[model samples]
Target: MKKYLPLIIAILLLALAYLTGYSKYIGLAWYGKATLIGGAGGIILTLGAYWFDKNRLNITLIALFAITTAVTYYYARIFIDSADFEPTAGFVWYIGYHIGVALFIPTVAYILQKILPQSASIE
Candidate 1:
């Protein structure tokens, strides 16, 4: 229940971004902003979980939530202003984007885990 809130929010955000035709303005700044917001939210949610004695923090999921939120926000902004918005493209775009992220996150995280300081690992 409480443990699932972050994922739920992430999914909802992605759904709105894609379904509402808002991906046209997505860009780096948008990604950065989303990342910061998602990360902060994850931290807060983790704290809540600890206080509530529900599920403990899951670093990988937290990272996925943060990264997905950031990416979704960027996609929304990038496509939001497209004059030729095709309603169908949103679904296709979401599937393709998520597939890419699914493949990319673990690999990138693996590399980062090796290169970055141990403190930086999501765990």
Candidate 2:
């Protein structure tokens, strides 16, 4: 159970991120969109690669970031037109910014996991 906790938390956070995006209440729909598609892509890629490769996690994370950035930009046109919000940057720049943020999750998680001390047992 302890070994799987981090995975479970990551999954839950992904879900929560999507829900928040779908809700569109916090004005961060781009994040929600990115997480939704990226996470789905990640899951699919992870499962598909699991049998052939030992680096499924890394592959999934990379795919998630790439897909999320692409999808978010693809969908952003519709969102921007439908909503009244204005973007400060061009579409390419906006997408790049979001991608940077989206990719931060895995990078930060990796760093934290490496820097933090592990517990001998989880209660």
Candidate 3:
């Protein structure tokens, strides 16, 4: 389960992200701040799996989490003002956003750790 978890999460997030981004029907409805207990709540719950080995407080992960959270927060501040449907100012929502913009480097690192030959993994 641990080994396959990342891929599973990636798939699920990819799906939600697709629905939320591409579909015309869904968009922000309510206005509020969502606090995740830890690690962007690790949107990668759905996303942060790649960074799981590191403690949630690790500076790198923390920075990534902050970036994702801030991004979503601002997306709301700048784009979403009311309860009605409005065309998105951007192509996608940056928070919890399918592995996240801030997390891309980590995800790639995680993938490399898994896919590249074992010899290459030697530190």
The true-versus-predicted C-alpha distance at residue 1 of model 3, in Å, is 29
lDDT of 2 by residue, 10-61 (tens): 4565567556564255333555555456455434443454444533446656
TM-score computed on alpha carbons, candidate 3: 0.33
Give the TM-scores of the predictions, in the order they appear: 0.30, 0.37, 0.33
lDDT of 1 at 92: 43
Model 1, runs deviating above 4 Å: 1-57, 95-123
- Model 3 residue 108 CA deviation (Å) reads 6.0
Runs in model 2 lying further than 4 Å from the true structure: 1-8, 20-31, 59-89, 93-123
Q: What is the lDDT of candidate 2?
A: 0.49
| Residue-level error in angstroms, candidate 1, position 118 | 24
Global lDDT of each candidate: 0.45, 0.49, 0.43
The TM-score-based order of candidates, best leading, equals 2, 3, 1
> What lDDT does model 1 reach?
0.45
> lDDT (0-100) at residue 35 of candidate 2?
49
What's model 3's lDDT at 121? 38
Sort every candidate by lDDT, greatest first.
2, 1, 3
Candidate 3 per-residue C-alpha lDDT over 1-123 given as tens digits, one digit per residue, 9 for 90 to 100: 454444445445534644465312332212123211222333344245334543232455567668777777766775667444354543334344433432533453455445655454323
Off by over 4 Å in 3: 1-57, 82-84, 89-104, 107-123
